[model samples]
Target: MFDRKEMMEAFLCEANEELQKLEIEILALEQSGDSETSIKRIFRVAHTLKGSSAAMGFDEMKTLTHEMENVLDGIRQGRLRVSTELVNVLFACLDALNALRDDIEAEREAQTPTDRIVERLRAIGSGEAGAGGSAAGSGEPGHQGEGGGQAPFEVGEQDAAAIKQAEREGMQAYECLVKLADTCEMRLVRYYVVAERFNSGGQVIATIPELHMDLDVPELRFLVVSGLGEAELKAKIEQIMDVSKVSVARYALTEAPSSEPQIAVAAAAPEVRQAPGAAPVKEQEQKRSSQTIRVGVDRIENMMNLVGELVIDQTRITQLGHLLRDRYPVDENLEMLEQVANHFTRVIGELQESVMKTRMLPIGQLFNRFPRMMRDLSQNLNKDIHLIMEGEETELDRTVIEEIGDPLIHLLRNAIDHGIESKEARLASGKPLVGTVRMTAAHQENQVVLTVEDDGAGIDPERIKQSAVRKGLLTQQAADALTEQECIELVFMPGFSTASTISDVSGRGVGMDIVRNHIEKLNGLIDVQTKPGQGTTFIIKLPLTLAILRGLLVNLGPSTFALPMGSVVEIVRYSTRDIYTLKGQPVVKNRERVIPLLWLHDHFNLPRRKRTRDHVFVVVVGVAEKRIGLIVDELIGNQEIVVKSVGSYIGKIEGVSGATILGDGSVALILDVTGIFQLAGTPKKIGSAPDAE
Candidate 1:
């Protein structure tokens, strides 16, 4: 016997996978209606789910899947054609399946009611529902009657043979139609009870829409092959509450020279028409090797923790070597120690790379879900949107991928709802009727850059300024003082929006701020670019991994700080004579570019060392396109540092991202480049100051 808990978990896992596949397949079918392979795939998934649910004794899931299988079977047989309404019903059933799966995970008895969705599926299958498909969904007199509504039910040669053999074994076969009251609640449960009654003494050979809940048609047909008489079956079904009617009919079965293989072949119908390209696609898929196994995230995280410890120890050992060399010069023992430290350093470096790779996952895992989401959103908003994705194979740390999904989703939705223009507006502007939103990800230096861009109406900074002033988020004077770029950046301010009215898709003004917060928390930054009549693009920059990074160690006064090398553009020395103030802010010219210069010690409230030299070392770092020059006392060179979070006691600091232990056994604050840029009040674009009035 199988462990019940293990079986349930396994079922849940497979069921969720099947449901997701069904969603993607259903969407594809809706787009390309002539794909025979997609229909067959959907049918097989539903059939397998039905069998699994039956085995697990999850009667509700089994019953709902039985209904889905009937519709899918009709589709596969070409009796029912694909339509928007049919695809919608299929999606509805998928949602119901998800709900049932969630209930199972919650340790509830799989009791999610699926009667309404089951009815809709049955109606679509029987031709009583859908646009221009049928109007008799209410089961009124004008609708096609039961005999003429659908193709006549016929037993395949294999089924006829089996029926004849059952008769020879002294079993009776009865066909019964059971109708229930239209107003009955918990109808699926009631149907399950009735199926159980027949299953007790006789086998339920088949059902019309296959023994689901009380459907919209108000009737169900069942075939039972058992020793129980027809009257007995009828009486048992009638005893089920809310069963309005039951009619039993006896049919004769004739079979001659039928073999098991013949029956099996007939029962398992071969695909009548295969898409021309499907065979090669299937062959290619099979040829591709699946050389991977699913590993739990916790296990990978544990491995990462061990690697992190190794890195810390390697740093300490290197520091010890420095101390030993300085104190015991020319000692053979110290020489051996140096050799061991060097070898250990190389070994640890290789170990860290291997462990980090294990934690790396392609960003495509998050990118693939957007197409379906965009399709649904476009339909909901009654707009035409074409979403294009590229560079999905770019890999990032699993932790970053997991946390980055929500922020990316917010950006995509914002692009669709606000950034992309409506179809009518697009045509009026001489643009394509179908607005396009493109998402791409790639490695930029040591960081992964993900962008969401659309070719629709760009942001109107004037509108944003006016909105800010009206919402009291900024005074009119402040709003008017903002440059075009600075006014657009107001979208990231909390509780600031430019929409005239609240909309379901956007206009809440909460999303952009949340997006920025989440990205900053992950040591990432979000930036936006807009043109007056073009469109908007949001660029997000994130490190490859959070566990370890190459950091440029810099000293301010007596304290040390680590700046992520991914954000460091270059290091330059500036003389005091070259530094000047514009609008009371320190600025410097580098290669004819005017860049803001900031003193780090002033922000951290640390006492600055009196400079004896006329020149100061400036580290030029940037987040997205905005660059800032950080003035520090000394350059301590670059090294790999293990990132550790500051204890919760102090929570978050203004410019500090996290803390990392250095080679000298001192904890250095890792500067959040994005935070510091924001702290410096740098404009998103250079020379973006408001024009003089």
Candidate 2:
């Protein structure tokens, strides 16, 4: 017996892959009408899913895919045309398949009903609805055995001799015609079931269509040599699922003997019609699959954890070597120890990189899902949207990919519902009839930058200010005082929305705030830029991996806190005389920008470090366009740190993202820059500060 659980897992994996391919091809077929390649690919995917589902005993999936195969076969044969209505039905089938797949994945059996979708597919296949219009090949004849005709199969000379021999042995030859119901599902499976029953009592000499499963023949003709009576054979055929009529008659020699064997076969199965390049493609795919194996996410995560530990140990060893060299300045043994530690550090660094790469995956896996979503959303809104995606090959850590999806989804949804102008509005504005939403991802320095931009009516800062004030999120004076960029940032404020009405799509004053929150949790930044009449763009910058980061370690009295280097803008040493009071808030001047200064000691309830010099060290950290200067006791330089979760024992901290161990084995809290900015609230203006030079 096979491992049933493993079998299901494999099936689910393959099913998801096939479904994704089907969706892409179906979309292509819709876009490039009459694309034979897309049609054939779609048909092949449906056929594959049909066979696998039948083998796995997923009756619902088997039945649904069979109907899908039938419809696709009609389109492939050019008997049915591609149209918007037909494409909609195909998309509906895809949706149903996804629902069924989800059910199977969760419960180990599909519980979603596929009846409605199956009926629609059958109707389209049978030309009752959604056939659009017949194509050039509609005039061609269908299955010869399906219509009234003489027995569709003829026995060969060898079969004739065998039949005669069988008769002499008290057997009889019979011609069987089986007619399936028009609404029958999995007609080929039913045909095979009846054929199996016939073979039980005797032998099936030949089938009209050469017994190919890919053929969508509604009627079957068989020449059987058996001892069973005609009534027994007819009863067996009728017992099948969709067999409507059966005729079993004793065979008679209708022609004279021939010198050579004579047999009849219908046209070769549709599988032979595959594109000429398919073989090479299949060979390449086989080679690729042979070289790779699927490892579970948990296993990769465990490897990453081990690598992280090695990194920590490497750092500690390197630090200890430095300590030994400093204490024994001229010792030859310390030189050797330093060299060994250096080599060990290099190896550990390489190992860490390799492990991290294992957790990286192309963003295409997530981007591929959006086209279908855009199709549905555009249709629902009665708008025309062309979504262009680029840089799908850019890779990011799987953890980042997982966390980033929801935020991306929120942005895209808002792009459609709020950013993109309606068709009429676009026309009035002299823009193109169809709006464009472009999503792109690429590596910038050590981070991945993803942008979602729309060529729609851009955001208005004045409107945003008004909305902020109207929603009671800010006072009128406060709203008016914000700059254009700051006004645009109000979209990320909770309970702030400019939409006059609420709908299912958006306008609930929710998404943008959550998007910002999610990105910040990943230690990333989200910013927006817009022109009044042009468009809007949301840009997000995220680290390549969240497991480790370069941190700027700072001392707050006896405690040390690490600030992510990605958010560290710059460090400035300013004279104490430059400090001024801005509405009771301490402010410092860095270049020309007025930065509010915060005391970390006060925030964390630690003892304040008294200034020992005329100059004070100020670390400037930022989230998007907002910057704040953090006052610390001392600067400990920058180092690579492995981030560790704070755990449930301490629950959650306000300004701390997580904790990391320093080279000295002491734990340092990693400051959440975005959270610290939030804790500081809005900065006091420099124009309002007293003692300003």
Candidate 3:
């Protein structure tokens, strides 16, 4: 017996893919309203969805997409032009389809009412909606004129030549019309039956309006240059189920046979037929390039877990090999162990790379949805903001991708709401009336840098300071003493809003702080840069993968800790003379900048060195725009370490992100740079580390 559950899952997967394509093509149509390619692309997706829904007995989905197909058909035939109203309605249809899909996936009845969207589509398809221009080909059944006994429709030059050559070869040409059942549930399948049945009898040279998956219409016209007589062709087609009638006519290529050929009056307009050998081979290759199979995400994640285990085992083997080398300096066994260890390392390295690649997906999957979002946002806010994206092909780990999506959305929304200025303001400022928000992703060393930039009114530090004071987030004196750069950084402070009036979009002062927190949780960093009249840019740096990271190992007395190498700037030897107290806080002047020097031992409750050395090490690290000097007893070299989470019983230790096992089989706690800053003090002021009491 067939697995009905498995089959339904397969259908849902395919349905989601088609829906994604539908969204992309609709956005393309909105941008390039004259693009026929995008129009046809959307039509094809809707047709596929309609056919599959009907096959699965999903009447609601089938009906919705069927109506969508009618509207797309009208657009394809040039009867309806792309308009803002049309785009909005299409977006509504897309949303409704997505809701239906969600219901199907959850095995629940679809509660979303699609009647309004269907009625709107019907109006546009039938030319009743003013948005739909003139009705060239009405979206109605039986609109396809008579074909048999009438002259065959005009064909392309190449096809015309092919038909004449076939006539000279003693083959008679007949135009056959196959009228399907008006209420046929599977018209696409029944139409395929007619095509297959007639093609088996004789070669089907050409078809009017071309054969496609859309079956909203009731009739089909095929021009067959074959040996079968007209009566035999009609009899064979009528035998197919619900094929109401079949008409056939013999045509001479030399002159008009009798009446004008059947002009396909259906929404699927008539097109000149191309000869058999006239199409480019690239078309077939293009179709083959897009062929793919869907796999469950759980399976991919399971594979990743197995690969992670192998990596841990590889680390242990290397450690064991090192111990043998140290113990047996002159033994031949050590050499053999080394060889096996090296080979194992090579194999595991390759295996790890392969598994990681599977988990790496192009960031385009997340970037593709933003265009439509910006479109709606622009209209709703009346800002006329244009979004530009770059480096969408940059790949990241799937876990990172999923975690970064919400933060990125928050940043984008904040950019549009706060960073970009209004049309009048931009014009007054001598800038373009339409603001531009550029979102770019690029790989920088072992990290991915995503930047969202906007060209509009730049952030004013004074306003930020005033806003901070008004919200009681900081004292007026504290806000006034902050440098312009520190003042601008106040946006990330909790409950900091610069907007004078609250709106539905933003001004709640909630987005940026949450965005910063979320990114920091993923072992990522977010920074902002703004110029007085020039615009603002938010740059986020995230690790390529979270499974493993390059960390700088440091020692505080006997306890070892791992500092993420991405945040470590440099290590400097500091003597007593190099450190001084400012406002009762340990401060260090490095490169003409005042930075706080915090002792790591105080935060972790670790012991400090009893005998103070003449010189101590200070590891300078930067998180976002804030710099801090970490006082350590010793500095260890950097190494690639696998990040393992701390157990749930001791969940979320302050100043500690996770733990990793070192090569010597000792667990080292990974330090969280952002958390360290938070533990010390706020962003505006860095207080002395707490005493270990």
Candidate 4:
């Protein structure tokens, strides 16, 4: 209630982060049967999200999280074990939470329809969730916890109602005594797990002081409540992973542990979830001081940029030392300079690596939402769609994460509307009724490649051809010459889409071109490949960060320019006699093919000096299918340049992507080889329209 607006925004950020953690835990838990800690971890996340959602006044979020909490409560109580189907459902729940969270953050003022979801959740809680079961049916096998060696509790009516209210306003006061079982794996983790379990149902009231370090007899103790009867609660507790036993006890004013689950702890203040302990709250006050601290990304980016400039300057200084050494040869002082320069290079290289790492954010930030997105979209379309995500640990520059969000959403919408088939269609196609879309990420050289692939009906070449002609992307004659793959790629052309009916989401190519544009702005590329009836896949390759481009510097028309070394095969010297004119175009033969050549003087409109030299530097470059030679005056060696975009308007200048200031303060434009090649009608991947994969 303290500054409601601020609290809402803070809650949104916290929930967003927690939701991401929840998704990773769920995926990890699904892959391992031994992952009890992971399972408990996911439950705790759901519990945290539930509290935050209710606090933020998101009714839809609150409702879904509430049910999600219940399912988690069942897991905590040991009423159910995770199954493949269960994980899918949990992912769906997480997906919903994510979308609701998104809408809130965007200030979209949108509400999701979740009435049926509530009914479904209720059924899940009552043991009637799957097909024909009902809440009134017999409980799951191994769900009972009436004996010792179990931290068990059952969900009774009174406890259920109390837990609900507690969730709405935060949990009321309670105390717990936790004793670690002999079978416990990772005691500290279990202690965390124990603490998390209590907090999930309701916040932790208090724990025995000096217990973790002291390991005293009362060393193992925790106090918690969820508004459910102790027996119902104990039933759930005893079933936790690695838990040898569980006992739900009440705490007296004297900090005594009550043996029976039949008793109730009196409620205290609004935020208080535990009864008053002998120790003050300060004793337990976030002992680790592990709280979130926010810093503007732009500031870090600025700092990183400055560091990059230092590297370039450092390199320049070493070059200066080399220049001085040549003139004043063979001296002990010059030898020492050489040694010092080498060390500087080593240190700077490491420093650059460290800075790059600081900019990396996990792809999990985005993957966390797909589970929820797939669920809602699938249900709305009356199809069964499975989203398989891989390489969730893949990292990207923070800026890439933020910029790529909208584009990824667009692709997901495309997969749902254009890639996936309905249940009936899938069944008729001799495929499983449940279609699948797999989103994967992997590191390829200095680039991060993300792919979105579907198993539904692939793009039809004829369909794309017709659509292209309809949208005027190509003339009928042009469309006629396009192979199936070529036709599918046309979907990326502006104003191209095949959907005759439009929904709130997709059917227009608003997002595809944008996806391509943004990726290119990051010096990335996108490619699309489809099978006539198999499905479509979009592959995107992006640089590690926009802050730097690994470039090979070369002299162009009395000035220097950086060509990304990642694409350069080699630099070969071509004598003027070896160069010939092919149909009025300058060409050079290197290895096999006659490479189309661009003269630095003519391309940049710079005055050319008389050719006193015997050779022209051939900067051999390739991007996708394009292999061309940039005829330059001299090669200036390779260096990683901190890429800085030239300001607006001029940025629109074809073939020049960005610029970086060199050691001597002169700015060199970074050549967009892909852009230049495309302009010169060379075969190469350009922008978002990727070559087929």
Off by over 4 Å in 2: 141-290, 682-693
Clashes of each: 0, 0, 0, 40
TM-score of 2: 0.78
lDDT of 4 at 676: 68
Candidate 2 lDDT, tens digit per residue, 561-595? 99999889999887878888777788987778888
Residue ranges of candidate 1 with Cα displaced over 4 Å = 131-290, 682-693
RMSD (CA, Å), each prediction: 13.4, 13.2, 10.7, 12.9
Q: lDDT tens digits, residues 555-589, model 1?
A: 99889999988888999987777787797677889
Off by over 4 Å in 3: 135-293, 682-693
Identify the candidate with maximal TM-score. Answer: 3
* Model 4 lDDT, residue 183, Cα: 59
lDDT of 4: 0.69
- Cα lDDT for residue 181, candidate 3: 71
What overall lDDT goes with each candidate model? 0.77, 0.81, 0.79, 0.69
For each candidate in turn, the TM-score is 0.74, 0.78, 0.79, 0.67
lDDT of 2 at 255: 40
* 1-693: candidate 3 lDDT, tens digit per residue: 548797797688778777877888889998898476687677767877887789888888899988987887677655677888888898999999999999998898888898888898899988898765654554533233454222224454466777766754556778777778777888778878888887686667677667787655567788777756777778878888888888888865532111111111113222323345435545544433222334556776677677776776777788888788788889998888889889988997897777677677888878887888888888888989889999988988878888998888887887788888888888888998889999999999989999999987789999989989988999988987899989989999988888778988888879899999899989999989999789999999999999878899999879999999999998998776777887678888999999888887766677777644566688999987689998887777887788889999899887889998877778899999998887768433343432311
lDDT of 4 at 98: 68
